[model samples]
Target: MSISTVAKKLPTTAIAATVIVLGIGAVAPVAQATVLTFDDIAPISYFNEIPNGYGGFNWNNFNYINGSSPKVRRTGEDNGRVSGDYVAFNGFGNPALVSDSVFDFNSAYLSATWNNGLSVTVEGLKNGATLYSKTVIVDTTQPTLVNFDYFGVDELKFTSFGGVEPNYLGGTGTQFALDNFTFNEKATSIPEPTLLPALFAVGTLSIGSVLRRKQLNQS
Candidate 1:
């Protein structure tokens, strides 16, 4: 083939090769899923403070009280208490009370961001005829293998005016201690094998173009 014909084909072949490599990288296999259990919460380094009791004490504090609200009072004074109908301790450090029996948990939130396939399950008490639960999908990068995936919940409102006192709660005035918690990451799906066909097509087109250019130069 003429020098000009060969030169033109060179750039096109290089471009095609680059495209194939990039496309394959984009469809690479996903990494393994990570599992974070209640024991993981013990480090205390991974969590952030969230408001839990009256007087603005928060969940990390030892003890406090809430008169008008269904407060999340720590079971024992000085952080001794550890279990109760309305506690949420993840086997880490101190627990906090969720003051105001009929209050709403609209402000509570997770400190860290999670990946697309990560799953977080919070196991807590639903006392005072008022249940509590929250699950959120945190936004993070692909390959959910990173540690400390955090999320938040809101609108945990409660009602106990009827004095029903759900079993989850120790009863009005009775403090509840947080016991356990767990977090886990669901596996990410791998890329499909069908994509191979498209890759092959791209490679074939590149080689065909190079041959066609050579033939034209000879003609």
Candidate 2:
């Protein structure tokens, strides 16, 4: 073909190639969600604490009461047994006390940004007896994502207390906590469209170079 004809075709070819690459990238698919499982429990004491007179344990002073009924008194052995301190929940109290305490699992303050959904399940056995067992659904739509803090207390009134025995206080055998928390997200359905711009830029440069060389030859 003549030089003029070649120059005319160069730009079209470059633009076509750029468009094709952009199309390919835009049609690419995204990724899938992930599941999380916990074998060991992590403490969130920053948000949770045991209150005095609520249970035999006082998280404020890190002490445990070691007496029966109204005679309950603080003991050194009761310290640091429970994970999170009080105030982790909107209203911190022993769930076993009057079956009124609702532990907030979002206290971990873990960020779940861009997550499609979050599922949390808490299971604990105190004193060889089941203290709390429940799964909480968390909404992750907010731009400012925050996780709940989990807390537990030793109540003298609950069967989970293991016969009001102080020896079983903080041992893993008697007190247990777990969080089966999972984060999920929708897979990227397509590759980013950014590639289109890049491809176009490269193609434009290629065509410009070809035209410059053609002009030089004609001169």
Quote the positional error of residue 177 for candidate 1 in Å.
Answer: 3.8
Where does model 2 exceed 4 Å of error? Answer: 1-193
- The lDDT of each candidate is 0.31, 0.31
TM-score of 1: 0.26
In order of appearance, the predictions have TM-scores of: 0.26, 0.25
Per-residue lDDT for 39-82 in model 2, tens only?
12233322233344342122232212221112111211112112
Among all windows of 10 consecutive residues in model 2, the one with the lowest summed lDDT is: 72-81
Instruction: List residue ranges in candidate 1 displaced over 4 A.
Output: 1-22, 27-86, 89-176, 179-195
